[model samples]
Target: MNPILDAFWYILPAYFANSSPVVLGGGTPIDMGKKWRDGRRIFGDGKTWRGFFGGLAVGTSIGVVQHLILPSYYGSLRIAVEVAFLLSLGTLIGDLIGSFIKRRLNLPRGYPAVGLDQWGFLISALCFAYPVRTIPTGEVLFLLVVTPIIHWLANVFAYKMKWKSVPW
Candidate 1:
């Protein structure tokens, strides 16, 4: 397989998990409208139960589909699903952490923190899946360099489509 395609395919589930939330998330903020000791919203309205779970579902489903379609390429279905689950879980965890830090810094929901917004999910996804299945150093580096650019393009596209209020 081409290295670029392989790396992209490996990270596809995490990408879907990270992006699904934006398109399918809303209602019942995960923090439940509570404020932290600093009198700021815990995770704000951006982090919601629906989005989190929805992302998990979407990402896992992508893995399942991949397993069904490409078992030989991805080892076993169990392994495929497991890695996808970890990546999806890690992506959301990282996003939540980023959002929490943003809230603490008084950055609004739509406000972009360059590194946090761009790399947090990808880094977290890699961390989670790395133990389960070690990615080649080259692939990891490829993802690290490409993700932010992809993220930027995706955000700009979303903004142009009016799905997002601002382009990051």
Candidate 2:
């Protein structure tokens, strides 16, 4: 593949990882109402199993597609699967960790986390997959910094559309 195409292939997962559960995942927290009890689910009403699984599926699919379409960029099929699993798992774990911290701090669900939820996915994915796969530290930092802002923007849009109860 060409240099631009190679770059696109390399960045695919980063962009994919930046995708929000609020935007792609088909559940809404506003519909659950403001009452904390009604809003309190695993990671609040907005964070559903469907969203989690959907993210996993998306991550895995992206890895698989990259392996098929740009094997030269990503190496072996096994590596692709590992990367996908780690990325998706990392994203969900990060969001969950953020929720735990929020609860400990007495922050209510749908309360803006500033950038926690946004960055959580990437951090968790990296940490979780660290043992299995090695990624460059600079690249990791780039993902950490970029993913949250991307997430925040996505949330802003989701909030405007009433797809999410809060924008953080």
Return the top candidate by lDDT: 1
My TM-score estimates for the predictions, one after another, are 0.95, 0.72
**Angstrom error at residue 116, model 2:** 2.2
Residues 1-168 of candidate 1 have per-residue lDDT tens digits of 788888988898999999888889999999999999999998999899999999999998899898888887679988988999999999999999999999999998889898998889999999999888757889989998999999999889888988778887
lDDT of 1 at 122: 92
User: Which ten contiguous residues of candidate 1 have the minimum total lDDT?
Assistant: 66-75
lDDT of each residue in 63-156, candidate 2, tens digit only: 8998897686557999888877776777677776787677666777768776676666566776766776645666666665666566777778
Candidate 2 Cα outliers beyond 4 Å, as residue runs? 1-20, 23-42
Clash tally, candidates in order: 0, 1
lDDT at 156, model 1: 90
